[model samples]
Target chain A: MVPPDERSRALVSVLGTAETKVTFEDPRSIPEMVLAVVEAALEDAALGWHDIDAVVTASVDLFDGLTASSIAVTEVVGAVMKPETRIAADGLAAAVHAVHQIMAGAYRRILVVAHGKASMAPYWDLTAWAMDPIFLQPLGVNFLTFAGLQAAMLARHDPHAVSRWATTAALRRSAATGGIAGPISVDRVMASPVVASPLRAGMCAPVGDGACAVILGDPNIGDRNLGEEDVRIAGIGHDVGPHHLMIGELTDWAGLRRASQRAYTLAGVTKPTFAIVEPSCLFPHEEELFVEAVGIGTTAPHSPGGGLFAGTAPVISGLSRLLRVVRALKGRTGERGLAHGTWGPAGQGQVVVVAETP
Target chain B: MILESTIRLPFSYAAGTVGSRFLIALREDQKILGARCTSCSTVTAPPRPFCSSCSRTVTELVEVGPDGTLEAWTNQPGNGVFGLILLDGADTPIVHRILGTINPGTVNAEAINMTPGARVTAMFAKDRTGRITDIEGFIVEQDDP
Candidate 1:
């Protein structure tokens, strides 16, 4: 029986990291995307495909333009003869599900991966399907439109909301530079056209192509754990709010608060002190909302560089946050950290992970 | 010069366990079937053979009443309105378009316009065939008031 409160005795580790080989013209296919993530996980875990027990992947079928997108990429994950589950939400949601399997005493040494290539389809048009068909979709709403709603709501009270969001966008775009596209300046962001009222095109995360993977195991294995360094997944929690406009409070995210409370309780964290905090901030306004929802003190380091605005790959955004937090924890300056991820329309769903150096 | 590269994605789909069968059954019977999970005792509309909650095999199938109450409803000015109707015999709600009974303009006017326990009934097509569209949509049961 899988207890809802069963703490994860199984510690998950991050291994070799390789992203999709992206180009303006020829981006990596889904199969190739899966292969890239598989190689990274196998190398990082210091094991071969023979060592893997089961696989849990994160993807949305609509985004992939294929029904049961996992089926197409399953072979490349090397799960030909193994158990696999696909999470329809964000990458972090998939990671959370994988942690449950480990703690349930179901299997040991599981692989969790997520990949997204936003270049394939029209992201805005596609995201419309995620909204409540009657209320939101008819408004022609997508993530950008939702961000506009959130931004406009905030701007109504604080006139500086637009400027602050623009500044945040400039910062992240500059940080994301050396990757696929180059950097942007505050002036450039200010000059960009408004995609939604109050939210200029510059205030959003750049759609990109990438894949990520993590290897989790029953901590009771070997002399130590799976990865060269032991990184324990202390707590995991996710929640979905009522799918309606009237019920959801536009100014506050009660769902994120509930999710974090549950996660902190499992991790046994009373005081959240960390050198790093990574949030899946798709828009600058969302970054503010996230920091407020998580109850992070002003003193706490928040998205040290920039968040989704830097580079975000839909389903992989949360895993990317995890990767950022892991890198921070690996560095000697880091101790405990938090990674936050969200999906659905207007942050209707959320997941948080609290991990500490072991 | 503009370079247009054609992309084609071809793959066989499951038609989903419930959605595919619902189409066939709707064509033949004009009655909707409910998938009842033997384990949790949950019923899904336009039935499937498996329980989503328990992931257990559905043991029984039953025809739901053509009559149900509007649990919630909404409309789009130019598009359409969708509602969740809680059928008389089923536990879960079925989502469908609310046809002539509710005005599309008023539906989209505000979210609070939808009230729970509001009585509504299915409006079937005159020709009578088994298909989701066979039930043209739901109509407000004005005879009760």
Candidate 2:
């Protein structure tokens, strides 16, 4: 028999969630953008700024082009005097930290926020700075190069991989409702400029500027809007794979698999039977890798409304995915949802969170 | 209206003991080096202090290759063509330029087979620096031998 998770003693519920429409460039500054999301999230949770006990945020200095970039959201997230923790990776990772604090009975309510702006500079250019200066960086190695290399590795065995990726990108784009790069044809996607070998511009997600905020709290704690049914986080697991793309499993997402397995065990999910799945796949080829890693079979409703293909911010992607799952669970359909996040070159870091209506 | 500003920040990184050894060998003797793991037996080129897989400190630095197999490649239209080369002795691949001919920029990409499993030999630069660029690129092996 599988052992039950002992550390998750307290059930952490997501009280509220909010996000901005992802755009190529947000007109407002970082603080103003964060403030809007914070206000909406507070309103959704029916809590005042004073009610927030602590704040956790996800951001990166290289992406934000500012040291301690999380400072921008301090006043908005109600962290002026309270303790605040900043995670330099994906937004969902911050939520995971918030979940940890809530489970530890550290605070009654914690606010998690993540923000990113691709428009500030050439986003891909910034990623090159993260690679090994001694070996990879001088060779002009960047994240896009990593994607192309992975796709090329996968295409070696499968003759039809390229065509399939084009189809997947087209499907995702067409399904997107308000996506910046709306509904492109499969033919057009194939003909689009090749950013990397075997991967085209159309096969990539539309990156933009945005912010996401979510409030988590202990249901046992008394609040004015206490409800019997709430969307609670059931499980969370994160794993960082090998940093080097060459040495690691280039064709598979080993880290994501392990993370999902750990999360599944905590959530008591015996199979890949999620009502909805939100994965942080930046490329169309990655959608295939995500499916294989999570072991989600043909039936799971994955990435509704085109998911990241619709358009998402860099650090905010994983967190925004969590928000989507939270919103869907509010219907109280007894549905189980999965939210995933990834960081570093390729799938170097992977985080998974499981949520359900209770 | 959009205002753009170009900012330049200079930085320096120490190559460390193992990294210095790897680069020194490439420059001094046109030889590729890989650090073998004490625990997992995995060898990673452009060697490091510890193994990427097992996290065990690697002490045995072995010669990897002047010849390797092309694992995968990409041709960025404006940028150059690059490939993942699986060195002869090493288990893992390293990313580097895949030079099709004497002049890479002018060569026709389709003329050369960019597919995996093609054999290639490393070409070293005449004037070498203790850097990754010491090995200029790998050229596809000719069959006329």
Index of the highest-DockQ prediction? 2
lDDT of 2: 0.85
Q: Model 2 segments beyond 4 Å from truth?
A: A1-10, B1-3, B101-110
lDDT tens digits, residue span A1-358, model 1: 1233333433454443444543333355778777877897678667789887899988888887776896678999888889998888888888899888877878777888888877777777688767654224433546555555556556655767677778878777777645455577778888987676566667777777778787777776562334434566777879886454322344677888889888878877676665678999778878777877888875566776566765668788887788777777763322567898898866888999986655
The per-residue C-alpha lDDT of model 1 at residue A73 equals 81
Q: For candidate 1, what is the interface RMSD?
A: 9.6
lDDT of 1 by residue, B37-130 (tens): 8888877665656774576888577778688876544443343445557787777666566664444333222333334456766766777443
Q: Which residue pairs clash within candidate 2?
A: none
Lowest summed-lDDT stretch of 10 residues in model 2 chain A?
A1-10
lDDT of 2 by residue, A240-283 (tens): 87667653478888889999998888777786677779999988
DockQ, each predicted model: 0.04, 0.69
Q: Per-residue error at A168 for model 1, in Å?
A: 1.7
